[model samples]
Target: MSRSLFDVAQSIASVERSEIRRTTGRIARSRQTCCKIMNGSGSPPLHRQGMDYGESKDVQKVHAAIQREKQEPRVGLEPLSLWLIGIYALAVFFGGAYLGRFSGSFSGDSLDPGTVPTKSHGPGPGGGGQQQTAELSPAERGKKVFMSNCAVCHQASGLGSQSQGYPPLAGSEITNGGSRRAAMVVMKGLQGPVTVKGQKYGSAVMQLWESLGDLKVADVLTYERQEWGNHGGPVTKEQIAAFRKELASHPGSFTEADLEPVPADANLPGGEEGAAPPKPGEQAKPGAPPQGSVPPATPGAQPPKP
Candidate 1:
């Protein structure tokens, strides 16, 4: 029995030795293959190939995720819709058309709806179609001059601003008096303290207007006298000329004191010998013939027989 047991043990040891040799051989082959691959003398092992395939798949997934998250490029982009371009074109066309339709010939006169453009009338036979310009009256001409020069001070209403030291001209004793006072003030101007219509004004100084010529002075005075319900008589250029000659020696502006001596009702020189017939309800001047009265006989002629 002991001999048989020893034989069985021997067989078992041989099997174990064979198994260890087989594992050692497998390990050595793996090392040799790894070394060959490191030395570039062998193909890549199966596990390396499998790992590379897995890594390639992971890299592709990462690249796909990055591409999916990327924003669209914006630089140099253009509008793409034909409908948007059509709308823009229509807006420009209608805007230009509306301006052309409503623009009134692009003329300054067209800005005023009430202003009518004057038609040019060509000369025709019998001189019937010739354009004629209506002449402005002395008062009308004076209005233009006043608006340009004096309106800033005296105002358009003829009621001067008292607070600003501009005395009113409407119904003022000086203005409604005679032509002499008005002409004197207008030609040389007024200075210092002066009273008008019982109000005192002296803050503002009236500048000389003698350079405006005799006709302009006369016209402006005539307009002022007749305007603002003033009953003063009309002034002539001749009268203004005469007054200018008389006042030539009088230097500088006049004060209220200087004008005090002149009579209010005094008439300027160079008046017509015989005044025109007074209008109805108008008072005639002293020593003047009555309206529609017969003329007196000459000194040598006998009185007319009854």
Candidate 2:
């Protein structure tokens, strides 16, 4: 019995050893196949055959999707359309031509619509091509000065603001009368209550314009007197100089009471002798003798025979 048990034990040991060797060989083969797949050098092992078909199909789908995608955009790479390029060229050409034609010497004075550029004059007998600028009339120059300095209070229309106490210059008795009163107001300035065209103005005060000089004061007064349908005569610088001398001792601005002493028909000194002739139907003073007309025969004086 002991001998039979020993033979059975030996047989069992040999079968166990064979099973272990088979298991070791299978594990080694699997490891080698896995390394080969990882290295990208061998076909799939038999155990991984089921997964190969699925992986290859997925890779093919990914490649197809990539091939169908649009390319990335790059700036300044595509050529501009022919029509667009032509339009831009046309715009540039026309714009340049327009600017060249309308821009006159690119000067500031050329921008005024009322001003016409004077053509260059050829060399004269004196042998010089003199470029002369257009000269402004006294009234025109006065208008510019008034617009810059006095337009804020009196306004461009000559119709002053009644609510603000500025007296209107248009058709006013003070402005339409002789140059004496107007010259007085301009030279010394004005304050206090004043009646113009029967309307009273008192709140606003006028500053001294004596510093404007005789020429500017005369010019501005001439413009105000002649403008807005007033029949007052033009004022001269000589008249202004004479008036300035008369008022040399007078202090400060004049009030309405101060102006009352001066007669409405009184003309400024030197105005009749040196000032320009009044416009047609205009008068230096209402009912005054017309310029250049000889006075009627004075009280039995012998008249010249025709």
Best by lDDT: 2
Clashing pairs in 2: none
Candidate 1 lDDT, 1-306, residue by residue in tens: 999999999999999999999999999999999899778787765654313342333778757655655467687775479999899999999999998998887886553213122455667764567554544556666776677678899999999998899998899888788778888888889888788888898668899899986777877887788789887777788888888889889968998888999998777788832323244345678897654568787888977699
Off by over 4 Å in 1: 1-127, 272-306
Q: Give the TM-score of candidate 2.
A: 0.52
TM, every model: 0.50, 0.52
Please provide, for model 2 over 1-306, each residue's C-alpha lDDT reduced to its tens digit, 9 standing for 90 to 100. Answer: 999999999999999999999999999999998899889778864534323342453778757656766567688777689999999999999999999998897887553223224566789874468665555566776787688678888999999899999899999888888889888888888998799988788768988788886777877887898788877777888988888888999979999999999999788997573345654345589787766567677897886799
lDDT of each: 0.77, 0.79
Give the range where candidate 2 is weakest over 10 consecutive residues by summed lDDT: 47-56
State the lDDT at 182 in candidate 2: 84
